[model samples]
Target chain A: MVAKIYRKCGDIDTKEMLFLPYLRYNQSMRETLLHYSFDDSSSSLSASGAWTLDEVERLRTLLEGYDKKLRTHSPETLYLDLSQVTRFDTAGLILLRDYIRDWQQRGITVELLGMSEKMRKLYVLIADAPQAKIVLRYENFLAEIGKATLRTLQDAYAYVQFLGELTVHLLRLLLKPWHLRLKESVYHMKQAGIGALPVIALTAFLTGMVIAYQGAVQLAKFGADIFIVDIVGISIVREMGPMLTAIVIAGRSGSSYTAEIGAMKLTEEISAMRTMGFDPFRFLVIPRIVALIVVLPLLIFFADMVGILGGMMAAKWELGISWHLFVQRLYEVLALKHYLLGLLKGPFFAFIIATVGAFRGFLVEEKTESIGLQTTASVVNAIFLVIALDALFSVIYTEWGL
Target chain B: MSRNVIEVENVVTRLGGRMIHEGVSLHVQEGEIYAILGASGSGKTVLLKEMIMLLQPLSGTIRILGDDLRTIGYKEASALRRSWGVLFQFGALFTSLTVAENIALPLKEFSDADATLRDEIVLSKLQMVGLKPEVASLYPSELSGGMIKRAALARALAMDPKLLFLDEPTSGLDPVGARRFDALIEKLRDTLGVTVVMITHDIETIRGIVDRMAILAEKRTVAEGSLQNVLQSKHAFVKAFFKDINV
Candidate 1:
């Protein structure tokens, strides 16, 4: 227990300072190592020196030793003499509190003495602090599996609901064309379409060259090198051009859409727009979707031309097939249905990328890092769905005997 | 006489090809709450950043804890940095870490204190900042606006800083929360003997807690002193700033 003494120094002492005895280190040494001594006659443990963070390790070792000594002896009362403590901090207070608590719990009376006013205030602050029970959520394997399954189901349901809402809004905008954000739509077109031209052209050209080079080698072995034109033109127009373009756009545009919209959501811009009676889907989502849908087919058409051109170049270089012959053969054999079908898949792929991107954007939570997470998920989900749809198209084409 | 803990003399700052502070100067004495006040674009935050060494002034001498910022080496700079703590406007807590971990991060990096000691320190800091123990296990995202600021303050005080820097400490808090925050800052300064330098626009906070202040205007410090000392200034910007807020 502390004595209520007022010192005429500039410091003000509060009533809580009485919770522990106060001492000022006017005559004490400027610095001392934290050490404890047992006064055998008085049966009291007296500690001296500066008890602070820098001396925390020595204090811990001494306390552990003291705990062992006390348990073996089982003293009726424990006298803690902190009179010689020159300085103290929260770390020192914590260690002392824990040591006293353990002894008191062992049915021994612990009497704290010689606490400085600063230390007592700190001690009371720590002692009276509400113990917040930390709740750690732990689930067994089966419970984790069940929770994951439920989360997946909820996410699927949300995605489907989002799709339905987007469809209704799209139909409404179609009926009233004046409501469309044409300027934003055009801006996105320039970003996702025109900006992507160089990369798409490069990848498609490389894919066609690879296909033609491989086909020419194989056809030359069978003495049917002329058939390389059919292989290059058919594969590039029917599959490679559209597939390559879709994959590239999904990585570039889809991720950007998710990041942009997710940031806007994080900053509460979307909430601000909604409060003003503007649908976020109409203002933010639809323009991106419309831009992708309009430009994807155009990108695919351009990819097809570049891909065939690359294949013609590869054919001429590898198999000595003249450009005239290759073009002439492509015109005769590359069916209109193949090109039209590849172009048709563009809109569907664009829809998948744009919807998934925008949907994931809306999923961003209040945390700053969630934008990165949603963007990554958007790109991954768009690519996966595009591939799945392309496989379904392949199955339909085979079933219909196309 | 109390010593000057931080002294900024004729600091000249330019950012992005624009001059921000032409010649700003001020001094923060030991064991006092000093405020930096300015208009919206008057570069109060920039000046705070400069003092914290996040931004270096184009030409100036910033002496903190007896070391010149312009001449301090990397090793000395880090050692000096550990002696002070900064509480940013938006809390700036790591989103991935729990409140406990955020508070303990500096201790973990700087000291060999064991896990039990670290946990105790974290709990003590939480209590000191008037935060409940349960809040420690929660992430930064789970916290309310006031709780976020308190949690951030706990983390800032984790190192037992000799000086504290706060940027718009009460900007987002309600009036009551702002007042409580002001009281907390005063109590912490009294108990810890730490000098505080803060940038705040809250007139209530300035009137209630600030011991001395400097008003920044016209790309430089136009007024400096206690509230009454600066109130006598004839500067137009200073007059406009405190016109509505009667002491």
Candidate 2:
């Protein structure tokens, strides 16, 4: 049936034969056609068509063909005749605008002639319309530097304010210990701390093993195999254990915090909480920060023990060092200050990660894109702060001769 | 008489264990404004989605522009889709794109027009929708409710579609804005000679704009015809829907 219909409607002549009388009776019918001619001194283009979307492709091709020919002649003036255009729409108007603008840009004087009243109204509506222009201004090097410095200073100021607010909340919670939501804090601890244990342990163990294996190879060359214990024991206790754990938690939990709070903000649930006479800091931020601060040191302590055990295994396998000797050397060389220094940084790292994540979350705008951007910024900021604070702690520990 | 631009026959659609439409059927003639009216949760939006081919009915035959939807191939369906445009309830403009870019999207995808022609078309479309060209640079978030609706209408009309579908075009507008939008729809129908299918419960729109209407009730279309024909309907739900309105 479709094939029969297609065969009957195959040609323009056949369609016109069947429908011309009806179209003529319709009285408002517009025939689709294009006629153009160019003289040696000037050019004239005439279009007679139902200039709508249905004829857009054909009109575009016809106009482009004429454009090529007109350019070759380099005519001083061009006349566009639209008197025969019985019907016109946006598509047709736009094509006409493009043609006139192109000719004007080529320094050719173009005249639009004889448009129907309706077509003229549409043409005037679009042709005389005001469009917004975007202008880009170039900046000097010093100006760019000044802008960057100002932006950085603003960000620092905002971060300092966030830290001050968080500290105030923490102090208030400490003063009124009963105000802490213990159940909510424990739920967050299970999510951000206990749920993270396996991956953290695995990564820490592998890091310690890699260090021991690599150190054993070099220590054996100098008959300094026993010193491998000092390298693994001191580094794991003083730096690697706490720093690695913090980095893992930042990637795992920091992004979650940003996404959760950002979604809540988007849905206006955060505002609802505020309207209900609940302080968002006391209800939301306090629980997350307190849970992270309490659980991070315990996680680091667990990582320290597991990482040293992994180092001992690697040392025994590669250096022929007995487990008893490795343990003895670890106990002999590792001091109380090394463990204390590493564990001391855990709470600060947790505070920074939780604060940055929550801050970025609250900063999210209403758009869905803002959530993704804030989540990415949360992870990056948390990890960077953790590393920077770790370095600062190292400098302080060294200066104090611990 | 104009041919049926859209013919939906005995469509049965079930979504998520709930029967949305059962054996519901309606036909919209060419160059006519057809409105679908229903109470809340009456599956009017779902039926519109089915008509637009965005959602498939469990069982039905939908013939659009004389082509049976199920028999058409994917390419043919896409080409058919280009022949029509849909305006969603909340604008549904691409959040990341500026108004001009959003309007230019369908043209850029379907037409081989040059960049300058496309931009000109964007400006023309904005003008046609009664928006200033300066609005072309604004994002959807920057637009007020009425401006967003106008921008979405511009985007829908970008390709000069022969058929236009609107879902609640005047729901969130002031009375003056709603009247203006109704006038715009009437002007578009007169100027473009296009068929329009709208889903709305706005009494003023029903009285002023729609040429025909269908009332969905009890998981099916209960009454369909001119506003007067529907008002004369003896169906309980249909009568209840128009009881409070001074139509």
Candidate 3:
């Protein structure tokens, strides 16, 4: 298909621009409409893929002018990311892809950067991707990397340092009697521990029953169906109790702490505290950490008992055994080490939750969206760290023969 | 008459490549109500916050009450800020605490200043702003718009701070309320003998109470001194700041 190319300068070879092989301007500009003669009823219906090679060249010429205009007029460097172009089977995409490549080959600086998976695949299909030399107006690869590097470096470094500071604060509170803040400590326990009991118990109970029901079906085949109590009790007491409690605390109280601090930061209330002679660590963080360390274990203990009972109920019903037999088998298999192991993990998990939550909150970058991000990051990081640490502890304890 | 008490010298502040404030230097004198009167986002809040070292300058010095604020640590900054009071743009009185508790917070936190001392201070401050001490027990959620402003002003003055930083004091108040607010500010200044730095776009606030004005345009000081001088200047941006205030 042939299309007309608008030439800005005289004596330019039309054949060199190979991308000029397709596309049609369905609607003509005033000058083009006046110059081009068309027959009456040349189509009452509009053209869909009625594009010609000349029209494609015309588009290229117009787009080149736009590129020049952009460079001269607007100071902002545009990210012409192609990710929005979902699908392509037409020469329109090929023309754009080619122009970008041609500009690159000629060492013409591209102020615009593109990002498109579809375009990327298409570009790779046609050529080994155009190595466009981006003459960035403030957004070079290094500048962008430097930007991301600075942001990530700042975010990660600040987060790590903040976590360290929080650790020191927590250690200081634990070691020194002076900064213990007993009253605030009690208040935090209520916030992080006691406040979370209902949800933790409910979740643990359901989880235990689910685990027991599954285990009972397997054990009944071996005529060792009575052992359903062992799996549910052991798992709940050693792994699920502490881990689930920690996750619940992270999801609930962790998000709460992040949001609270985030809101304070957004409103400059935290800044107000700094101006008012109060260290946020001492006033805000110490209380929450103390609360979590003291309270999360107690919640886990409660969850453990509730979970075992729930498991016993599931086992008794699934195996058609008496409740008393289930209780005997549970106590027979459940060792004090399992109880101790779960309790030990509780304080560690609580520390991670409170530290991550408070750190995420303090790290909130003073905006509306930062609060949400901090809250999400706090929960995710807390859960991930909790599960990871639990796995490590399990391995360590198994080797230690605990 | 520049009774200069605060000296902002070569202050440069930037956030992620864009300079929010640059080479912004200005002064506020003792006993005079200085206004950083710019059409909002002229870095008025940024400048105001720098007075008490809320936002640290990237490269400059701010002398508040004859002491350089930048050299101080968190403790020192708080101690310096304790002597001054700030009214936030959002009327940031503690929503959790009652109006009385909100006003009494600084004193309670920093001082063992008794409940009796607090009650007396809270009552006096509330009365100073035309709010009854009876309304002291009510939470911030319960207060009306003008009341919240008065309460916020009352909190700002509760500590008897020698320096007061108010960001758009009459922003949410109605015309009558805003006028009354301006009057209240005047009365408070006269009685307290405190240096005030107000950032406001309210024309009435300017004409009525402003002793001197600084206009921030193009990320730096466009004009400084009396309201009349800034309004009359050949600088179109400064002129537009005043001209647009009425519009």
TM-score (chain A only) for the predictions, listed in order: 0.86, 0.78, 0.63
| Over 4 Å off, model 3 | A1-156, A170-178, B1-247
Top candidate (DockQ): 1
- The per-residue C-alpha lDDT of model 1 at residue A119 equals 71
- What is residue A32's positional error in candidate 1, in angstroms? 5.9
Stronger candidate by DockQ (2 vs 3)? 2
**TM-score of each predicted structure versus truth:** 0.89, 0.86, 0.45
lDDT of 1 by residue, B46-66 (tens): 999988999999998999999
Compute the lDDT for candidate 3: 0.72
Each prediction's whole-model lDDT (CA): 0.86, 0.85, 0.72
Model 1 chain A, TM-score vs. native:
0.86
lDDT of 3 at A112: 35
Winner of 1 and 2 under lDDT: 1
Model no. 3, DockQ: 0.01
Candidates by TM-score, descending order:
1, 2, 3
